[model samples]
Target chain A: MGSSIAANQLVWHHDLTGQVLDPASLNLFWFELTEGAYGQIHRVKAIVEIVDGSAWQLSFNQGEDPMETELPVERWLSGRPDRPSQIEVVAGVDFDPIGVTAACRVAGSPMRYYSIIKPSCGSSHENRGYFLYSWQL
Target chain B: MKIAVISCIHGNYEALNAVLSDIDDHKVEQIYCLGDLVGYGPHPNAVVEMVRSLNIPTVQGCWDEDIIEGLNACECSYPSILAEQRGKLAHTWTDQEIHPETREFLAQLPMTLRVDNLAFVHGSPNNQHEYLLPEIDAFTAMERVLGTGADVLFCGHTHVPYVRDLSDGLVKVQVKRSGVSETATQIHVAPLKRIINAGSVGEPRHGRPNATYVIYDPESAEVKLREVEYDYPKTCAAIIDKGLPAIFAWRLARGLEYAERAEDPTHICER
Candidate 1:
């Protein structure tokens, strides 16, 4: 997951190789629900950028909106149906079990969360989603 | 007799107005509502009052039951966790905003209403939350119609409209005794049965923000699906202003379910 970062954003994208995205993982979605339940997965990817002011921003994908991006990381996402609104990252302390922390402000409510290493196992495949830093609340 | 049927009018007074106008154009004698008169939109009481004023024979929907008796049908709400959260928000908003008289009106509605051989129900004969998807097996479809003892069953709840014809139905009965060999008898229904889904009058989910219903002609046995275009943006604005879940507005604008669609078509609603 970290391999796509633009260098200084968090060193080099972590060389966590050959990770296949799970269709049921958490993410934002927009459109008609497919027979598989989740909608079209165009160029959608979870992007959590630790920005200039020691804050991080999360979007399913970086889109036209300059303030916030419309993207989902998994099958389920919280926010507007078409795309998530701009969530102001007010604070990010050193979160445990992962690299960073973040409090996202959505619809005038502060949702505080941090990163965690979620390991999911299946019979035939085991794909890991890792980054230089991931947070959970 | 030509009858007009509507269902899943989740409190959008604007869409209800448009559908009623279209039904008037069809010159139908009777108008039957397949329930879900309230929930997920701006004006619940206004929509109920309109239906009451029109004297539309209505059945109780899952949302109506939830508001009156409480939200117990967890499975009927949504499939996604995020969608479930939004469903709770909408349900809570509706429960808080619903008037006492409107609640009484919804509580008095029957689950199933029959007129001669034509039956009306919100979802299926089994329950309001059970979805009779268009692609369900033929035997199950025939069973739903036969359960009502009706040649034709008119229903809604899936929000997507469809028509299914149950033809060439055969049932075999077998009896076995300890001292006798198994005996079997076959019975067949001569006339083909039909399941007509009225779709949704307010919150539609057929890929467009237009209301849908069905006009049934008893003489010719013809079911015509009607789609009506309304000022949906008005309802969308109301959803945001009413302090309901904002996701409902986005979904409503696109003719999607306010929360989520039915996940399991075969699983009967246990709630």
Candidate 2:
């Protein structure tokens, strides 16, 4: 893959509950990881984004705790085109002391889940115009 | 021998699990997957891990190749600019989300796999991006299917499943041997050659939301298409929570086109 710039670090409130997101409205969002008894994160991954009034949902999990979220179309459009806007982070996030503390940064912390390599990295490597991160949520 | 084939599992782990459970109930000797272990859905890592752990023989699909060989535009027939953009976004996310080991597994996958007389590929035998639609011409279809030179060719790419049997006309074909002084020998063309598309296990576009797969019974020369329903609502909600495009979540229940969400107010996005 071609090397591109890293996504800017943005403060995000990971939503574990699937009900907070409204499918009617499109937006950018991400999910919270569910840990097994062994402290290993489960393989569930979720992301829902809305574009041109149509919402796109992508999640993969066969086991328990399949988390969901809703990124309202407005908030998805309000960011600096590179980051999600700070608004309704988590509607009813479970009480996790670590997550709660991590969510309290005054300035945005480094993005933990945004390590997507830019798409313009291979044979078609010259058209390096605005390499967007694939994760809209 | 009874063989099971699954393909185009674009990360909908629920569907994959359901299909696997269903496959377990049947008595099959060998199971083969026709690539595309990731892309589209959210659980690329899990899907890759499951297939790897099971030790299923798999051939790489176009999307799998893209994910492994540096993300690029997919060959899906998404019509609109918004759809194309969303598709690209999903691929990119999958590239980032996949485990390095999984990526390595996909990278080393062969474009086609053969066992005895059966051949497996993601698209056609020659090109991974080729779409062997059901309505293709007999001669054109024969050209690609014959490239494998196998008695039966099994592939998945168009997602919609079907079985196409092309019979080679009975004729006396002449063959010359380099070491022999005899004239060309005459032989009859073989029986009907078959192409079986196993369809998509994660996402189905055949106007039904059930997960799809195929079981080929060599003894009876039969291809059985199977569709099993899983927990789609959970998947839809996960997609939304993960912040992927909402339309993907909305379409799982109906197996309808992306634009169909607009016409029906009862769609998941509307609710």
Candidate 3:
């Protein structure tokens, strides 16, 4: 676990090595969640940029049009029978966790998170891993 | 007899709750599910337990099979890397989160269920992953579903709602978009063979964020395509909270397909 202060907000962080992401591999996802009314969980509204290693980023901004990419991520999200209104990020932030810090707004709000770091398909067998993380406000 | 058919729950408890409540309002005599009880969303165990307590007869979907058999990945047909990536996350999380009893229910689920002249399946009578799309040739579709010898076949996999009538020599098709009134689109089938894609209860792909199912009244010989609105924000939030893919939660509000496919503008019938 690690702690950093940003904009008078004490943000808590965790390195999922050997926990969510395989410690032996050089790939993993870093994500954050926010708590909502009535104890519902949501994604932390923040920008994620990879400073080191390879990172894959997918973002669903709150009140913003979903990005138009090869995949209709927004349309699919809207089409989900559950009808989630909050923004979410899945495996968007993919990178090696040795020196990565995700900038998230962690003041006064509670959130939960889970991520995975596994081997890519059609790739050679390697020491791949899965990882998870949760931060409650 | 009036039978309510639901499919492609994908583990969203809130959506299932709404759909089930709506079904109750309809006062259907029997309820059946077309498989895919878990996948994409959160609350796999909760959904499984509810279905079990209600004792809804269900068929096996590809995701259910993946969880029961401990498969590495779900049989989702997404061509995009991002969708594939998130799908992997959903499968992995759901595989771990499902209750053992849920596993048992999914494990013992039959691939197909026949009731008199109607057949229920997750995808098609032949394969759980096989899609019975609207553009499928009528004869080929007939051959695929004819194995059960049921004149009316109901299946769900594509998450889209459609009805195809292959009676006589003509192939009539009906695809319902979201917001279409339930009464306006009531299907009265003729003596010709028919196939109905019941759509998804947990995840809809018809560009609508409502939970969908089918109400087939044998007494009236009518099929009603019903879409009910649920607390999507609650379910979506639960998905992210459970550490599943955020995309899975985010996509539920839009009600559209995640993957892209080459559009075939022309509808051709194979002889």
Candidate 4:
């Protein structure tokens, strides 16, 4: 039964979001891992262009946080501190209503989700956008 | 002679059974399926076997592709997750339900087929991933149908039946109001390229739970959309017994359509 079943099943996999570390003191980072399996080690970078001409950079490393010294100690040690699985960068832009461009790289793998989050100022008064760039590993 | 095009069984053996019983007497020379022999619905294996027994020319729908090749996993909308979960359940119930032979059969189905100048596609011809509904104007339909080079194109992804005529250089689609009961409906308009959705055989979105099929005669250039009543109780029971999604089975009890919330990306349950 196992052999018959295995023959019919089709295995599917996707790339994980590359690690991005934020050095800003007030920003935050979160990682949402893919469900099933992981692929080869691929490098990814996100260059976030702030409205005020400032920019933030996030990078991925296999066993260490590339921007560990720059991130807030509390958040940097919050989840999976022992082994840096993935990285996320949270930055605040002072520009009242401006857009940020994010570009990610995973070598041969494709980036699944990317977006600029604009937190609400108390009463749902901010606009934001999410874009996904997906490709095979 | 009349030809009924039905696709996307997605399990739901009862619905397929009901539709078949309803059309048992109809003089259908050929019955075409738009793919998705299993998924979401109950009795994936049973539904596949039945469609195969009927000898209908079935195409490989997106849902079918998901099961066999994982083509749209990243893009499978939220409702699709629920639908996929149901498929996985069905897969486990029947010992991985679909066999290699069935998977191969489904894989070989043409994405698009032309019968007497009418092109039949499970989704849209331009992109099998697209869902072309009747609500969109004829211009959108024309744009999608531009290079297909068919007098008529029939699709069934939205599970909603509609007709669009793009002959007079103006695009116009006739939206069949849901819940209108009619034995036979006629579409009287000449079109350079016509778009028609045959609706769903296993699941009908219109308030009435009757399975729907479209009969078109190329020789006479006449088309009629017809609905046949089926055994809803039996279908619903099979769905329930299989421990499928309660909504998946429950929705069939009443012909009310499922509405997907805007925030939800997966709205497969919504008709």
DockQ: which candidate is best? Answer: 1
- Supply every candidate's count of residue pairs whose N, Cα or C atoms clash at under 3 angstroms: 17, 23, 30, 7
What is candidate 2's CAPRI-style docking category based on DockQ? Answer: incorrect
DockQ of each: 0.06, 0.02, 0.04, 0.02
TM-score of 2: 0.59
Ranking by DockQ: 1, 3, 2, 4
Per-model interface RMSD values are 10.9, 15.7, 14.4, 15.4
Which portions of model 4 miss their true places by more than 4 Å?
Answer: A1-137, B79-95, B170-191, B256-271
lDDT of 1 by residue, A1-137 (tens): 32353422322112111121122122222232111122221122233322111222232333332223433344323221222322211111211112111111111111121112212121111211222222222
Model 1: CA > 4 A from native: A1-44, A47-137, B75-77, B173-190
Looking at candidate 2, what TM-score does chain B attain? 0.85
Restricted to chain B, the TM-score per model reads 0.94, 0.85, 0.85, 0.78
Q: Considering only N, C-alpha and C atoms within 3 Å, which residue pairs clash in candidate 4?
A: A20-A87, A44-A105, B10-B39, B12-B42, B77-B266, B78-B266, B79-B266
Give one digit per residue, the lDDT tens place, for model 4 in B90-209. 545544556877677767777888766778888788655467777666666776665466778888867667777678654344556669654444433435777888777776677677
In CAPRI terms, model 1 is classed as incorrect
Model 2 segments more than 4 A misplaced: A1-137, B72-78, B169-190, B257-271
lDDT tens readout by residue for model 2, A1-137: 11321343122334422112222221111222232211223233334332222233344232554445554444334322333322222112222335322222211211221123322212111121112212222
lDDT (C-alpha) at residue B93 in model 2: 79
Q: List the global CA lDDT of all models.
A: 0.66, 0.61, 0.61, 0.52
